[model samples]
Target: MKKILISGMAAFILSLAVPCAVYAEEYMDGRTENGTALSVQAMAVTEDIHRVVDVLKTGRMDEGSAGDASFWQLGAGTFSMSRNIMEAAQAQAPAGARLSSYTQDDLYILAHVICGEAQSYPDDEQLYVGSVVLNRVSHPSFPDSVSAVVFQRGQYACTWDGNYYREPTPQNWANARYLLEHGSVLPGNVVWQSGGRQGSGVYIRTRYHCYCY
Candidate 1:
């Protein structure tokens, strides 16, 4: 995977400076524009995407697949993943695991987490936070599912601070939907996230969140 430090908002902007073509693929097909295949986890799914759109339009989290991670990164300024766990995720997927089990419900849950964790940030910052969650789901070091990662104790303030149950705005839902449908060109290896205060190895920092590797 590409290794780089997401220092702050400026770095985040720089990362997005790459042309949109760099992120044109639908779902994680595991191949770049150059046709070089990379070993990524399986992300196959069969749910009607219209269902995901429905939730976004309506602000519901109870609609979809569940539970939640690998690699390490920080979001907002609170959550984090350890390196010990990341190696474990990689180990579980020798050639990389498939995410065929992921469902539209899973997609909604992810959006919920993103809304609770980053609804106030700029759209791109919210995308980066959502990317970290997807990164963990595919990584071997953490749990292999979305619900597990999201509900994991002490990982997200929204989960414990009661923000998770708060209904997401249409904008927040849209941001989450965008991330799920269009993978970030930024490093997917991010697995740890923090809020309120900064942490070491920070990759990107918005006004309220800090993403680290």
Candidate 2:
């Protein structure tokens, strides 16, 4: 454990230091036999690249994988340094604990919770709801199984309000199966959600809930 922590910290620190190139240029100058002056050209290639990077960073980049990080330093001010560090950490990270251990019962439980929470929403949002449950099952802070995360007391209101017992729609079942097969449309760390923004960890929002880490 100590070795792993040290390695991770070392990797994180080293990766964070991978600076974004703010400036670059190539110039070649040679005098002709007559020593005539040649045309001067300045492309400002670095500046153009910097400008493009600035714009691209503000938009989404594989947000489904992004959800697990709780928050990303997306401010253009930080630039690619943070992006590289995140990639490093994810590369070494362990798979969600016991996520592959889920059974048929867990699938039904997931479908029921989706039915209770997001059945009326679009098909994707319904899958997002199911994804939240699976993300929790794999996260270190929560229980490690679908049924455990869904019924883990006060975590999901539907489990208590009798809504979870409803027969799930066909779409809900499909969403549940898709989650177990293809994984979340959300990130792996987004376990908390509410009607409005809840915390500093905000990731995305749907019609009925704000999902966050």
Candidate 3:
């Protein structure tokens, strides 16, 4: 009887230790193995919008919309989507490469950094525009919502030009989505044209300010 009790306790301890050992090994392996390479999907129109709405709801909204409502009608929805994108990007980033570290002003700065890297317009434009639009919505001067900011007359250049601001092509949208998800601000203090003639192109100020034509 004594032997059986001792053996049972040993087995129980061993069982517990085995799982703990496995967990420790997995964590150590993850650290040594270069964390899983994330195959982040490009932001599709539907997917991106959905992500934005989820974030906005977490931050400021109560409940989202019911069906295919008007853009303005789904203001909180838009904010939620942008917020979701930022949060997800922050999650996959390496240490110190998070969008959340930046303030709204910092986000404005990062938007320029992202735009500078863009190789396409409109869809690529939307990434920056979407970021900016979220800023405005969250800011005091704007309507306090993503859809509101985008639909506001004369607010976004693309909207005014009838660009439709639809889903980006696969490649361009992928690049934009990646930047939105993973781009970070390097250490520096510089300003590039957010918009203008030179501003018409994307601008970056790292290693001195430059624009992508």
Worst 10 residues of 2 by lDDT: 20-29
For candidate 1, lDDT tens digit of each residue in 122-205? 777777777777777787777777788788777878888877777877877887666666654346555677774333244445
Among residues 3 or more apart in sequence or in different chains, the pairs in candidate 2 whose N, CA or C atoms overlap within 3 Å are 67-187, 68-187, 68-188, 68-189
Measured with C-alpha atoms, the lDDT of residue 107 in candidate 1 is 73
lDDT for model 1: 0.51
Q: Which order, best to worst by TM-score?
A: 2, 1, 3
What's each prediction's TM-score? 0.50, 0.54, 0.28
**Model 3 per-residue lDDT tens digits across residues 34-153:** 222211211222343454345344443333463323433343443443344344434443231223332444433333323433324555343443344334544455564434545567
Give Cα-based local distance difference scores for all models. Answer: 0.51, 0.59, 0.37
Q: For residues 1-213, what per-residue lDDT tens digits would candidate 2 score against the true structure?
A: 733543354344333332212101111112232111111111222333333344345543345556323223332323344444344334432333225556799888989999988877789789778877888877778887788889898888898888888888898998888888777777666677788755444555556787765
What's the CA error at residue 171 for candidate 2, in Å?
Answer: 0.2
Better of 2 and 3 by TM-score: 2
As for lDDT, the candidate ahead, 1 or 3, is 1
Off by over 4 Å in 1: 1-101, 196-200
